[model samples]
Structures are given as C-alpha cells and as structure tokens.
Target: MVSPKTRRVLVIMPAWNEGATVGTTVTEVMNLNEGYDVLVVDDGSKDATAKVAAAAGATVLRLPFNMGVGGAMRTGFKYADRKGYDAVIQVDADGQHDPRDIATVLGGLETADIAIGARFADKGDYKVSGPRQWAMVFLAAVISRLARTKLTDVTSGFRAGNKRAIAQYLDHYPAEYLGDTIDSLVVAIKSGCRVTQIPVAMRPRQGGTPSHNPAKSAIYLLRSVFALLFAVTRSRSKIAVQEGTL
Candidate 1:
C-alpha cells in the first residue's frame, strides 16, 4: 500500500463554470484525510469556479481562457511534474466521481502506470445508449486488444497516472475531440505505459449542465472512429522517466 504521507499524490480536478458543486466536491475530498493535494484547474471559467475551488481548500490554477478538459488536464500534469509529484489523478469537477474510491483508483497505480475507474464494470448504474454506447464499446474492445487487457470504460475520465504516464501525457496529450480520453490512452499504451481498470460507481453530476446532447451522441460513433484512426497514425513520441519512479 502507498502511504499517503510518503507518496505525493495530486488530485487534479478540471472544472469549467462549476461554481455550485466545485466547493462541495473539493470539501468532500479534503475531508477524506487521504493526504491528497487537491489542485483545481479552472478552465477559463466565467463564473466563480476559481474562487469556489480555492475557498474549498484546493490549489486553484486559473487558465486564461476555456481550454476544454484536455487542455486543463495537460496543464495539471505539467504542474505535477514540476512539483515532483509521485502520481496524478484526474477527477471530474462535476461531482460524478466519488471521493471514497479515490484511494482504490490510486491503489491500482501499484500494478499499472495508469488506472482507470470503470463505470460499467458491474459496479455502477450508469448507462449510455445510442451511438455513443456503441462507440465506447468498439473503442474499448480495440484498445483492450492493444493494451492486452480487458477495459470496460476506456473513455472514463476518472483515471490516475504515475510519473511515467504523466511524462508520456505531457509529450502526447491532445486537445481535440475525444483526444483527452481515447487518443490519450492510445498514445500512452503505445509508449509502453501499462494500463488497468478499477471498478467504481459513477454518481450523478451535482452541478453544471450536461455537456452531451442528442445531436452530439448521434455523431459520436463516426467521430470516435476517426479519432482512433488519427491517434494510431500520429508520429510516436517518447519521454524518459526518472529512475526509481513509475
């Protein structure tokens, strides 16, 4: 087991205009006494996201403008690397990610460079329909084969990464559509990062409007296929991880 006092674990929460729930989410995590250093990257929020997060006891990093989840997460990784953190866990600011399971997800890093919290691993009531579900299934199957492991939710944003994974992400994390989750994983796996999944239940988002819609879900499959193609075809980039670090 990784001792909270020994390993520096930074929980990065990417938020966009989530003033209503960011405080509560941060508070819950802070109360966990898990020795987690919470960092909330305010992705150019127009509202008081930065203020709320800071007030909730998170180290708030306010981006100049909105840069989606991909951009926000990349920034977080860079911060972690600069600060010499042992691990980085990407948690949603919308409260869909449960703070109780943060340790379980972090524990997976003991066996793998990247640990994803899977919602559909017979542990959560979360369900998706239409083309989005099909796209997720197809992507998961293909990625599972590539990673040589079965992953039920490859698109899950509730994921944690060790030092190696952070270095890899800094080298290849993308900001395009679906690139943050799908494309990011493909690059990490190809770069020799071992990945594993931890079953976790997803909670309803406490605040903020749902980002997905019927129109978006309708085109999810087509775009997802294209994303996969582009990710694999991109030129490979590798980074050197420090000795004795994951």
Candidate 2:
C-alpha cells in the first residue's frame, strides 16, 4: 500500500477561460493541507485563468490554443507521469467538485488503479433526468460490466489515477468531446487497470453558467454513445498503434 506520507499527489484542473472560479478553486485545494501539488492546465484561455491560477498557488501550464478538456487533461497526465507523481486527481476549474472529498477519492487508490468521485451514489443531492439521465445509466452499466464493478457515475470527471492509470492515459487520452471521460476509462480498463469509485456530492459552479438545454444534452449523449462504442471495439494493439505507442 502506498502511504499518504510517501505519496506525491498532484491535483490537476483543466481550465479554459474559467478565470472567475479558477482562483477560488485553486486556493481551496491548496488549503486542503494534503500536501497536494496543484497544477492548472490553462487550455488556451483568453481570460486571466493562467494568471489567476498561478496567483492562487497552482503551477500553471499554458496551452497555445483551446484544446478542450481532453487535450488539457492529457497534458496534465503527461506532466504527472514525467514528474513521478504517485497519483493524479482531476478536479474541475469551475468548482463543482468539492476538494474536501478529495481524500476519499484518493483512498480508492489503495485497492484500485483509478478512483472516481461518483455523483449518483445516493450520497449527494445531485440528480439527472430525461434522456441524458438514461444515457448516463446505460453508459455506466456497460462500463461497469467491462470493469467488473458497480460504477454509478462513469461520466464524473472528479476522479483520481495511480501510476499505471496515469501512464495509460498519457498514451491514449483523446482530445475529442467527452473522450476524456468514457474513452479514457475504457482504455485504462482494457489495459488491466482496476477502477473504483466513491460517492461525492457535486456543488454548483462558483461562477459562470452551465448549459441545461435538452436538445444540446441529447446531442451530447448521442456523441457519447458513439464514443463508447468506438472505445469498446478498439483493441489494445490498435490503440497503441493509433497513439504511436507501438
């Protein structure tokens, strides 16, 4: 077991024009006193996200252009892998994910390669409805079967990864929309990484707004379903070759 004292944990937040909440989120994570080093990948933000994150005690890595969360998170995984961090916990820059539950998420690393902070575990008031909710349930069911474990929230970005998972993500994490969530986990699971989850109560974004339009949500779900299918059929050898890891 990797003890907390011996573990070097890196909290990575991928920010794209999230200047308002990034600073607050960074500060909150730093104040956790968990000795976690915070790294905010500024994914081509046109605002003061980089400046704010750095000022709030996070190591800021600037991307040349907006690469979305997938690109930003891959950069984070690469950085953590190269720097020898024992685990990488992904947090949102918008502050929906609570930093207090971070330790609980990390605790899953004791027995699993990847630990996710799940929202639908009845631990929190977070809820979903309609087609988006159905899609989430279906996706979780499929992914849970693949991982041979019950996962309530496969789409949750609030998650942690140990060394093996980090290496896998560095090689195959994609930049496509929602690819970071569904596709990345599939790759890690197919590559022999154990996955687990802990229930966490998601909070409202500290700043900015979330899109709750039904039409957009349905479209997003459709794309996610396709991403899942593609990820499932992708063989390890084919994935390696596609990512130039072969």
List per-prediction Cα lDDT, in the order shown: 0.92, 0.89
Question: After superposition, which runs of candidate 1 have C-alpha atoms over 4 Å from their true positions?
Answer: 1-5, 240-246
Best by TM-score: 1
Provide the TM-score for each candidate, comma-separated.
Answer: 0.95, 0.94
User: Which digits, one per residue and each the tens of the lDDT, describe model 1 over residues 146-189?
Assistant: 89999989999999998889889988899998999999999888
Clashing pairs in 2: none
- Which lDDT value does model 1 have at 198? 97
Model 2 Cα displacement at 175 (Å)?
1.2
- Clashes (backbone N, CA, C under 3 Å), per candidate, total 0, 0
